[model samples]
Target: MLTHPSDPRRVLVERSDLDPMALPPDLRRYEIHLRATFDWGRAYLTNPHPDLGRSGSVCPFVSASLKRERFFLAVHPGTPSDPAEAVDTMRFYRDWFLELAPRSQPSAQITTILVLFPDVPQDAVEPLVDDVQAMLKPEYVGQGLMIGEFHNGPPAKSGLWNSDFRPLRSPVPMLVVRHMVPTDYPFLRDDPEQARMYLELFGDQVPAQLRDQVERERAVGAP
Candidate 1:
């Protein structure tokens, strides 16, 4: 976790008195929600890509990286009504996210960051999600942190399954942050450049068997 301080006043998770569920000290809130949403727990998090981890659940690997201090979740309720103001807020989030990474440690657990824009429609949330990704991805290469948005928007096609089940689909507009891994190639393959970048980022840590696919992705991405 980052040693840098965040203003407790502005953050909801810090204000546990207001919403105890914001960031529970124990398994209370998180476990309950995990059970309540089968798709997120049973399907997405648990299911691994055949191409990636044989047949193991993706959750255990990711969960291993996380400790009680590593978890960070932010619930933002609104997107400003004004267009320009909304953009400003998005940029602020992008900047804040960059700093969320621990200063002393270049690498850490997934350090999940979930931004909830519940009042905002999918249309609004989707574009903002793109904007944030565009703004931060390049700066984060090889840095080990991964961030994503989950809104009422369209479901992201599964990288692990043939079915149309969208693991990223959620009821509210939420953005997630976590540590990066070599197995993420499935998600980056569609964008050849991103795939190459991801390969470069993970470097030699990529598994021996997956080298073919990784090199293939880099080759495909080459100009």
Candidate 2:
């Protein structure tokens, strides 16, 4: 479903297409990272954990994405330490995500793209992974899309249910792109402009319990 065949910065691989034995030596690392982060790790993003507090799974949508073959992992061709290069690489995946098939409701919601930076040194993760996410997040929100940064480093953001638990941690440095769902209000609520954009996108569709919170945040106006 990847429309950008000419852009060679990354190679997109579907969850169902991952086969460690079949991959060449150079490409095998990507498969290993994906498996460790999403499969083998006990505290993986797709699996449910007791410490996760209220969650059924660390990410409720990942299991469905895997089963539906909608989960995609892109192997970045190089580990660019520059924030601008990282942002540009992510922007490529973002556009590819938007152009992917099954561009309809429900199905579209489960589709996600995780762009992996397997070679990025762990120490550089904060700037290359986290900072890039911070820079592109606003523009992504404006487009009704959500992007998240994940890495082997300590938790940057805590779980909603358990404050001490770092839910975003992963085995490899990566950026995830997915459609914005109504429940994502919590992420947007802290920023007035982001919150306003969420309200405009979801409006009455926002969950009844969170509607007041979104409106209140929006009322604060952009600072």
- RMSD (Cα, Å) for all candidates, in order, is 5.9, 2.8
Model 1 alpha-carbon drift over 4 Å, by segment: 1-9, 12-54, 65-67, 82-100, 103-107, 122-144, 220-223
lDDT of 1 by residue, 119-186 (tens): 56656777776555556554454354565655555545453644554556665555565656666766
Top TM-score model: 2
Query: What is the C-alpha lDDT profile of model 2 across 1-223, one tens digit per residue?
Result: 2325775434666655558765545667667786765563334656788888885777877777878878777777567957888888888878878887334756899888888888887777777888888999999998889999888685479888888888787778888899998899999887878887888888979888787876676676646
Work out the TM-score per prediction.
0.63, 0.87
The TM-score that candidate 2 achieves is 0.87
Candidate 1, poorest ten consecutive residues by summed lDDT: 9-18
